[model samples]
Target: MPPRTPAAGSRLMQIGEAAERIGLSIRTIRHYEEAGLIVPSARSEGGFRLYTEPDLERLAVVKRMKPLGFTLDEMRDLLAVLDALATADDEERRTLLDRLGMFHAAAATRVAALRDQLAVAEEFAGTLRARLDHHGSCTT
Candidate 1:
């Protein structure tokens, strides 16, 4: 059987393109799919996974969360909160918002920690460069 293409004017793309556009490896995307973090928007007749813009957006969220040290379960929970916010009733919306706020706070803390680590690393590199300069200047 021939491979099926996306419908006319559709913005769907195959997994490779989706991975590239989302700045994640194809393997990572597949792993996310296996972890229930995302689902492809469609599949070609040949069984190729296809993704739409929203699918890419979902992957993007996971990508951003990774560097912040969020575990798969945290990522999945955050994604679920985001998904529920769209059409949630007022009471549910309030609960979801609270959860979202907690995630935001956690991310902010993690980012600050990363910044501190980066500063320390940069300082260490600077010290090494200073030592090299001093050694190179010595007359022997």
Candidate 2:
């Protein structure tokens, strides 16, 4: 199959296309914009949000954050930390690195919580399978 095409003229992608590429919904992208986590690279003449490669990169960061159960405010804070790293002085960069470290710790905690939840879910599924095997039937 041929590679997908970008929007005509400019290389920017429309919001729907961007969401599809990132495995997210347009509503989620809009929410991220509202949360000040990311902004569209441009708006088309028809008033649609258009995204560039850098914009997609930002979206990808937010996407990763979501599965880790990061709050919107935490997401915003992390985005600020990332933005500041670009032009921060050494001392400021050190501070940002500290902030980034905090986020990493939080992610680790969340991942552990998710693992516990998954274990419970799998145990429940196994019990159900045992019941099904005992009866050789699946009613309700």
Candidate 3:
């Protein structure tokens, strides 16, 4: 594994605080662990998950992937590809670079799909607003 970045502070946070910091529910954070997406930085003496800044950054990546609707396997693949790219050399570096390019293309596709969905959602919202306005004027 590539070395994790040095955390700004050595202080470790429990799972709840980590979840709050990442804007995800505790259960969701646990689910990410279960999915092998992110591992806690450490375990306390009582066995509670302890998270550091690097761990939070990993969770943040998963959060961004969640919004883009990336599958668990896709997330795992991307993480592995990124890790490899960081330390790859020569031939391996070229292959990892190609993999990164594929991920970029896939992300662009997902973003375009999201844009289409958003446009449809906006039109629906506009329809609802018009109906609400009509009903409000009638009710008055």
Candidate 4:
């Protein structure tokens, strides 16, 4: 049987499409769901998971956090902060903004570390290329 469409006026998609659109694998999306980082926005009549644009946005956030080496707990906490900010009052918004700032700082530090590692890797590759060039010249 063909896949059932979402209700009229909604743009829900199944797990496979959600994963592709979010640049994640289905298993990764399911893992995030299990970890409470995100949940599908709805389900089809046949019980397949359906996700909305907001759901995919959440997954994109998690995807970004993963490469920065964030733990599941960290991801959950960050997601909570982001969610609360949308509806928070002035005082609550201040606290949530502070939390969000911390996450941003942590991500920046991780990105800088990765750049340093990449620099070292590139230098090593260059060394190897130089050695190969030296050997090739000696053989000629």
For model 4, how does the per-residue alpha-carbon lDDT over 19-64 read when each residue is reduced to its tens digit?
A: 9988899998888888888878778899999988878888899999
Alpha-carbon deviation at 123 in model 4, angstroms = 0.6
lDDT of each: 0.90, 0.85, 0.86, 0.88
Give the winner by lDDT: 1 or 2.
1
Q: Score candidate 3 by lDDT.
A: 0.86
* Candidate with better lDDT, 1 vs 4: 1
Q: Name every residue pair that clashes in candidate 3.
A: none
Pick by lDDT: which candidate is best?
1
Candidate 1 per-residue lDDT over residues 24-97, each given as its tens digit: 99999999988999888788799999888878888899999999999999999999999899989999999999
- The C-alpha TM-scores of every prediction are 0.91, 0.85, 0.84, 0.91
Ranking by lDDT: 1, 4, 3, 2
Give one digit per residue, the lDDT tens place, for model 3 in 53-83. 8788888888998888889999888888876
Better of 3 and 4 by lDDT: 4
Give the Å shift of residue 114 in candidate 1.
0.6
Candidate 1 collision pairs: none
* Runs of candidate 4 exceeding 4 Å displacement: 1-8
Q: What TM-score does candidate 1 get on C-alpha atoms? A: 0.91
The window of 10 residues in a row where model 3 has the poorest summed lDDT is 1-10
Estimate the lDDT of model 1. 0.90
